[model samples]
Target: MADPAGLPPRLRPSTVPPPAAVTRALHAINTCTSAAALAPLRVHILREPALLRSTAVISAFFLACGRLRSLDPALVLFASLPRPHVFVFNSLLRSLPQAPACSPLPLLRHFLGLGARPNRYTFPLMLTSLSSLRELNVAHSQVAKSGFARDLHVRNALLARYAACDPDLGHAEQLFDEMPRPDVVSWTTVITAYRNHGHSFLALATFRRMFAASVAPNRVTMVSALGACAAHGAVDTGIWIHQYVQKLGWELDVVLGTALVDMYGKCGHVAEGVRVFSKMTERNVFTWNSIIGAFALVQDGEMALRWFFRMKADGIRPDAVTLICVLYACVHAGLVDIGRKIFNLIVQGEYGFQPGIKHFGCMVDLLSRSGHLNDAFRVVEAMPSQPNAVIWGLLLRGCKDHGDSVLSEHVTMQLLELEPENASHYVTLANLYAETGRWLEAHEVLKWMKEKGLAKDAGWSLRMLEDRSSKCISDGNFMECAL
Candidate 1:
């Protein structure tokens, strides 16, 4: 016998020796990091039945490496095995459910092609891969037909899948109600489903049901509930969840701590949001984006900018989401110079980073708001491609503010032509014409609006009284021609 790692024997078996070649092949296969390295090893292994030391070990290795690449490699290895068993089949099938762009239907077809039947592990991943309600129904039918619908894990995964896709929450609630023996995971999944769909009340109701059933809320459950409370602006319930977290002494963990920061920030408690952020010993990009967005939303643009700079200083790279918030803050505070500088830095000065429509809109808004209508128009013209409706609309608004009748008229024609059904475009154009004392043009625009069977939506204005601090609402639906 040859040392598997050394050289092959002088007189090899005509049929090839099984254990030795397999051991050597497995060693070579294990060292492969990328798909390219696997090709030669795979070819060498497939040449001789001796390539696999044990069918079992080879199958396990295939599945283990499946995480790095996918089930395709495992499936290829399984094809060459002398005696492929259910374990190998199961490994490949299990890999399919989580595979990149992996389809449950295709995996099921492959299983059937292999003359193998799905066991308990099969349906859990299949149900998870069903990206939509239509796919869920197909998986649900397969589960029922396979007679594994009652299996706890399979059923729980199915419940989670339904919870994720059932936007109305009515179906998910009914399914949860019918489950005779729901576990903590099942309860949490359904509760989270409601939360994800923006049904905060139902999530709370689900929590109450869990407590009534004597089920203790775990970290996942509490975190989800806190998130729901924050999203729906349930400040009181959010506070209660915080107290519960403190009681359980789980606040130190970064994951839950970040969620708390996000929840408080969204609920308009900037102070609490900052406190939670300070408590987080480990902060990810998501945490930074959430807190920054919160400050922007609350009109604390300077605080938003401060945190943005601080985030970069702390060695955290600013992602597109961070830049979007920063640009928005600049727009809110009318910081045109700063906005222009940031825009130039990100879009032009940076090597790989590119600006999207959101960034362009910010620039247009910044230039337009500061009465630089021509500069704003020039920005749109200089865009690599044609401007979008949003881009053009920003210029039109700037035209309105600066009373740039020519620019307003030009943008109005372009906007209306682009988005004819948009009622605001017609109104904006008509307003521009009226502002310029072009009664004939204004009436013609209004006439076209009527001819197109589009009724102008009544416009309203909001004004705050300086002395009384009271808001006055004025109905400006009826157009007035001062000319």
Candidate 2:
């Protein structure tokens, strides 16, 4: 018997004509959390003459229930409404995007049929569900036809749609530069598209260009550039960016701070990573993961474990990423028992978190490093399903570690079947054969790899430069890259 519309007392519309019906419908829409409430609300509106005709009342109801449960009711209500206008169609189209289950194509068809020109809001929402470039190009054409091209918001959304669908960043750049004056979102979208396409240098250049144009970068711009710096191991540039962030008094932002830590960590500045991490006022799961990984990468597994325990004690739940980093720590520290314990925790602990391929790979590495080749094989054999290339690759590497020729051969065959083009598989198997002085067999394996046109990789060097003054150089052995 409570008023079905659950408007807060302060927000309740006082001057509205049908207060009780409005209040009840609003409550049903806003307060309704389940399908049962939605069913009754639908019946109530249909039965109530006053509520049936008010667009404001119906729109409020749909907005309150959100898109998932409101679609069918919206359609029913649209059919019954005496004058369903363009705004009504727009509302329905907007709702279609809220749920991944509902396809936007039907809504697009309906909108076109109504001859309703898609306003600025329409294409952006429609672009979200688009899966292919062809559909996106169609949407892009519609935007031009509607003359929203010069509208910055619509253009920015178009840039985003292109950035998302187009593998090449050319269209993104063109769209970005064509804007009369690109705003921060425009610049950020362009930079992000380049960064995502593995053009880190280009992303960094864009940021500089934005700055050179007297356009100030926002938090998103700085964060994205910092990510590119991190990936490329440009520590000096990263540090300069960090200083800029601090000077602007934005260093306290958790997102930006976390990126700084990750950048420093990946650049081989572990101490700097720890320093940035310590200064963070707010630590997220990613923050913990970065610091732990930094320690693990530096072979300071003890510190990684320390942080892992601290993370749990701090009441932040560990996710698969957290576990993966901790498992790597166990691998580095040669803590087979600890690795097994962590593996069991993931597989059967109170959280009952499912183990991913990386987790299983860590387990295999741990077991193999401990001279437990058969146990490593057992772990692979006991997997819930067939193993992936990583699992088989790890097992093969473990066999190499323990000089187990038979198991190595078996794993090599499996790896070849899983990833036939992987040159390293043949190389690993060849190395195992050579260990037993089976030179001919080893040479044959290498010959087969060459014959298959799988090119073996050579070692590479990474030189990160910061201006002409500061540089940090690091070289990685091929083992890590090969795996």
Candidate 3:
């Protein structure tokens, strides 16, 4: 008989220990720095009946196996047992997620085959593996059938899983509603779900409900609430959260501080964002990104550039997002020489990596908007990846704005090839022809569009004075636009 593919002829399948013995078992496992060192310990632990029986001991064993990329040994020990402990099964289920492609379903089947039952704690770990809405539905049913549906921890896991995998929050909300006494984790899960799924108002509403229920918001809960406030431009709500944080005497950590700064930045309160940044005792790359992005939002490129340097001076390495934000700052402020300097650093891999498409896009925007159309054209041509329609479209619009009819026609041809079905590109080219007094070319372009049954979206976007959002007729929805 051939050995199982992954099992080296023999295999057994497999947190913190509460007991001193369990703790010692974990320590024994942890002390092994390498697989060779772990091998002796693995042999001892697998043979120790007492260690295999303890929940934490076995869980740590699997974690050790996972850490060493040696789950096969854990599997061998697990399979060798005629009737493994429930904790042993649960441990394997939890740790298998680390392997990603390894599913715990086979272990589950074997456990059930041994006539062993999974408890409430077991289902939560199992649900972590669910990757699709269908899988979530199936797990929820299993949770119900196994009589663990009412278990709060299990239900919270299910709620999180649903939020992650489901298209909408309807199912997650149902789970939240059915919870008898939802705790901070429960409320936070739902609040975050609402915020993530573009229901900022509902997220805020859920936050309010969580507040009214007398469940004190944790740092995590407050962060999600602030995110909702940011999305909807509810600066007032953000202010309230800021004040509440102050009242609570909670010092601003990197994550909480970043979220607060980002909320203020997105809401157009640059000074407040700066004040928050100054108050932060420690700032990571993300925190710096937020404050710099705040400056970018307000088109204060010089200030953005100042902070960008300050971040590096403070020993924080700027990430790709930070560079993107700073580049956009240059684009908005039309700081051509400054933008070019930064783009050069990107091209030379000064930041430890070559420029990606987004960096190139920002550089192109900076050059084009600064009326350096030919230079922008060269950058696009030199891009490692194929230029998408958006890149071409930006250059085309730049050509029109600068009255470069010749370059505009060339850019439009690229756009036409890239997005053949897009009628707006056709219309733009026709409009450009007419603008340049090429009436015959304009008429011919329009005629070709007509022959292709293509029509430009009438009233592409209706700009409203009271609302910056344009009610786009093309998509039948309002999208934010500033002119």
Model 1, 1-483: lDDT tens per residue? 886889887874578544665666666666666766655555665666554535545664565556456456666776655445656556665555443575657657666577767778777756655777877788888888889877878888888878877778666677678788888998899888888887888888888889899888898998888888877888888888889778878755767877787788888998998988888889988889889988988878889999999998998888888888888888888888888888998877462478877888888998999998888888888787778898998888788777788888899888878888976777666566555545455566666766786654524310111111111112222234333
lDDT of each: 0.74, 0.75, 0.81
**Which is superior by lDDT, 1 or 3?**
3
TM-score of each: 0.79, 0.80, 0.82
Which regions of candidate 1 deviate over 4 angstroms? 1-18, 33-84, 97-102, 106-117, 165-171, 349-352, 384-386, 456-482
Candidate 2 — worst ten consecutive residues by lDDT sum? 461-470
For residue 463, model 3's alpha carbon misses the true position, in angstroms, by 22
Clashing pairs in 2: 5-23, 5-24, 5-27, 6-27
How many angstroms is residue 357 displaced in model 3 relative to the true structure, after the best TM-score fit? 2.5
Number of the top candidate by TM-score? 3
| Number of clashing pairs per prediction, in order | 4, 4, 9
Residue 480 of model 2 has an lDDT of 32
